[model samples]
Target: MIHGILNLPRNIWLIGLISLCNDSASEMLYPVIPLYLSSVLMAGPRALGIIEGIAEATASLLKLFSGVIMDRTRTAKPWIILGYSLAGFGRPLIALAGSWGWLLLIRFADRVGKGLRTSPRDALLASCAAPNQRGLAFGLHRAMDNAGAVIGPLLAFALLSREVPLAHIFLWAIVPALICLALSLKIRESAPAASAPKRVAFDWRLGDMPLVFKRYLVVVALFTLGNSSNMFLLLRAKEVGMPSEYVPLLWAAVSAVAMIFSIPLSALSDRVGRITVLVCGYTAYAIFYFGISATEKNTGALFLLFGLYGLFMGATEGVEKALVVDLVAEDRRGTAFGWFNLTTGLFLLPASVLFGFLYQGISPTCAFLFSGCCAIAAALLLIFFVANRRP
Candidate 1:
């Protein structure tokens, strides 16, 4: 089994394996962190918000620098390895947290690792894929990542069922981290071209990214302004009377569906147009949010809506990375991805905070309606400004 996986295309298989292990480690701890904070550590909503805010803030701040560093050094692999290793090791630190302060510190460390890794890893993935197959490559990576999402929670569930402590689950998660570390060593770095400069300045000017990519980035930021954390979505579902016991199952279902659809949808974008498939994805999100808003107490409908939500995620996540690669020059790929993530991550804080307020003040339905409207508006923008203009 190991040999078969190793014998597959090096880039694809390596990325997939790394994602599998990393996400397994992440998902094992992520779902329970808030609960642990509130229940065990006696933290409140404010603390939870602060933890998440700081974690994401750390990621946003590092991304631009990390990208510039990767491009200047013309080396992505070392950054990638370091970032994942930090994140992998950081998970166990959460298990040792005796207070919310300690948890926040650990979360910051983990996201800092994420910040360091993402842009460089994306650059490496782009380098590995054929131009035309970029969408499929990213999609496969996401699928494998979500596959770990599926497994991780299930592992958590089993461990919890066996009366295992949450801390132990986190500690045991290090096993996957070790696996990811081992796999990271196997991925040979893509050789840089002779034409590529040996050393570019670490200072990336705003002018370096093209006008089209900038415009697209604006639209993505607009869309992300309404796209908050999935934690809020779970909170909203529970607020509307969905039991806690069934929540993981809903998440698991979404991951399962996304895992199933990601590769095929990504491959479809390779044959069709990336933008076209992406617009469809945005439209699906709009419809899904609309369904969530309109349905008050229908559990059946909620499950169906969540399933479709998975499909939307499957279609867009990888394709978006492929589209970034399409829009930017090879040398500036790291910067492009960094800018993309930075913009989106910046918006998420306001979006999530606002959504929480909306859910608190008006209604959860209003929050869903707000999300749906933004998604549709984003879809329209993509149709007019992006998809139609692309060949």
Candidate 2:
């Protein structure tokens, strides 16, 4: 397995390591933030939804423009480096947050960094990968990323067990984040001659793209409408009597499962076809959400379902990325990734707000039920509209 992964280019490995570090820092902060917002900062669930939704929405909007920047410059490294620097440095500012508003500002900055970097980073990865090995390369990257999540939460758990203050832990995230930044700076861009021909101006119209790509984006938007913040899942676990201290462990468990499954499942996509794996992934997500919705305060069931949720993530995350490369021209890769992320991000805010409303207005079960139904609908659309056309 190690030898298979090592067959990819050196830059791919470097980017993977960079992702490992970056995700480590992000995950270390993630499991703690909701609790901090609600418990320590005295915010409510709606506030939590608003903050997360807006942060992600900010990233999405930037992604729409960032793609054009990448396409015009025909370079990804500089943008990538700057984005990582901002995200890494900006996130620790949460330690100084005096109120939920302050936390919102910090999250917005971090997500802005994400918005700037994500498309370029993905374009960089695709550029580095061989056509035949794109699936394996992306899968390996996601696996490394998930591995970092596993380590991050365990470290958080260990620190909290030692009674370390949460603010101190938040500050410590800078260590890995900065390390990722340094590693990111080391990635050498392929020569410009290898890139798509320079277009005179940026064209933002979806009509110019392949019909298959547009259809895929529509399916993605539909799916994202149901996919809210994972924080809600963590909150659900807490509501079911999982202790606060063990929250990191629960996160670690989910990441561990993803780490274990991401690479192999992604490789399976390379063999079987990306659409098949994606359809299965969507099915898994629906089942997981429905299961969670139906189970009432059962910690054991929640743990199992969270692991299943991880499986859902493992199957789709990298595979979907690789699929986009297959759908567009090489020169348009950055733009394609940008649009994909934008559509997903566009729906993210309303999706999260809707989930929060359903949870507050009716019940958590209703939110999950709504999401499950949407996932099922999106899966069918993928089968008819996108998958059938491609495969």
Candidate 3:
């Protein structure tokens, strides 16, 4: 199995494996975190929103700068190594968080690591694959990462079923992270990137990028406003009658679907058109959120909706990124991905905060309906405004 995975060019599959292990460590704590904050630490949805919101927003702000630095250095491996190590080290520290306030700092630190790595890592992925097959490469990456997500939650479920404490589960996350760090030590930069002669000038201005890419960024920002934290979905699972003991498994199920579907669907985008898949994904989100709003009593329906949500993720996550790769120049790939991450991550603060408030104040149904409408609007705009250029 290891040989089969390693048979690919070392530059590509190695990062995918590293991401798999890293995500295994990170996600081991992901599903149970809301439970930890709500039950043990005595917090609310709004508090969880604040933690996720602040952590992501801070990471995004850092990403904008990190991309510029990465393009100047022309070496992704060192920054990638440091970023992965920081996040690996950060997750284990959550066991020591006495309050959500402390957890906020820890989450912020973890996401700082993500910020440091994401743009460079994405640029690396773009470099490794053929232009025509980028969707396949990125799809494979997302699949591996989602595979780890499946593993992590299943591990959490097994531990919790065996009556292990949540804090101990957090501590156990360190093991996979250590393995990930060891693997990352071997991630070499491709020869050209390692030996590049000139530095790419840093610029974040709109005029510096492609016209279509700029318009696409506008569409992306619009979509991100409605795409809030997954914490809400986990909370809704319990509200709809899924037992806390089964929540990890519920999370695992969704990830499993994404893992299964990511490769095939993303490859499909390489053929028909990325925009088609993206529109489909946004439409799926609208339906899933609408379904979630109505699924107050049926655990079965809630599980199905979460699975559909995962399908939406599988369809869009990699394909949309491959589209980004298609739209931007190779030299400025880091900046492109940086802006992509920024647009997605920056707006998430208000999205999550507003979702929390609406769920708490107006009603869960009202909040979900609002989000569904946003998804529909984004999909329509994507179809009409952003032209998919197949090359």
Candidate 4:
């Protein structure tokens, strides 16, 4: 499996490296931002919910359009490059922030870069690999991404352990972001193949998409409605008696588990089936969320459940994209990915808000139960209604 994955492609490997750098930088800030909001700025869960919801929704709107742009342009590298550049510069600006509003502004710019880059990047990844190897290619990319997530928090932990100011640590994220930008420019872009047929008019009409893709989108949107911002999980760890400084390690633990399991599970998907692996991943998510809902101050249980949550992410994240590619025509992949991301993001805002309110106004158990139930429903729906086709 390792040898096969290593044989993917030069562009795939480079893309993974770029993802590593980008995610490394992003995770450095991600686990810290909530803490910065609550502890430093003295904000509340609702504030966190609003900030994440708005930031994600802003990115979703851009994702809705960026796919069309990429399809029209028939090139991804330029958009990918531009997106990374914005995020690279934008993330560091949080260091100067004195209020949650400033953090919100910084998040807006950063996620806009994400919204711009994601679909095009997925398009490029699809274009570079053979159809048979899409699972491996995406899996490797996600593994590298999660590996970076692991390293980023460890780096943050190191810096914080030395008594570095939290805001100052935000500035360090720029270094990896710059590295990601520099490496992204090295990706070689090719014009569309002459043998390829001309594409239809690029638009957001859902009727234009294939039935399989549309059905898959429904399942995806359902699942995403429960996939609230991970900040809630971090906050849960804190609420369960984990100390503030140790939060990054908890995040790293999750990422490390994700990094470790991504390749094996993705490769398994290639052999068994995409939907099978997807269902398993969703089941794992449901179980983990349920466990989180029920557990108390048992640090051992929290750690174990968090690691399983990582396994859920590893199994689903990249493989789901590979499945998306399989369900659509090659020419429409960018648009398909765009819609996938757009709808997912669209639901995330409300998801985050609902989870936040549950956590604050009710309890963490209520929040986790809601998410777990949603995951189960999405999984059952996919098995029964969406995954009937072989592709």
> TM-score per candidate, in order?
0.91, 0.97, 0.95, 0.97
Residues 125-185, candidate 3: write the lDDT tens digits.
Answer: 8887887778888888999999999999999999989989888888987788789788888
Clashing pairs in 3: none
lDDT of 1 by residue, 1-391 (tens): 2343233458677878899889888876766675577668997555665577667867876887788778877777777788889999888988889999999899888988889988888888888777867877888889999998888777776776676776787798778888988888887876767787554454444676777788788789889877866766555565567665556666777788899888888878888878888888988988988887777666787789889989998999998889999988888898888898888878776777677667666877888789888888888888788765553
Off by over 4 Å in 2: 194-200
- Kindly list the per-residue Cα lDDT of model 4 for residues 186-260, writing each as its tens digit: 998887767766768765568778888888888988998899999989888888888777889899999999998
RMSD, candidate 3, Å:
2.3
lDDT of 1 at 61: 68
Which scores better on lDDT, 1 or 3?
3
Going through the candidates in the order shown, the clash numbers are 0, 0, 0, 0
Model 2 misses residue 67 by how many Å?
1.8
lDDT of 2 by residue, 113-169 (tens): 999988988888898888877888899989999999998888888888898888888
Each model's lDDT: 0.79, 0.88, 0.86, 0.88
The TM-score, computed over Cα atoms with residue i paired to residue i, of candidate 1 is 0.91
Residue 46, candidate 4: Cα error in Å is 0.9
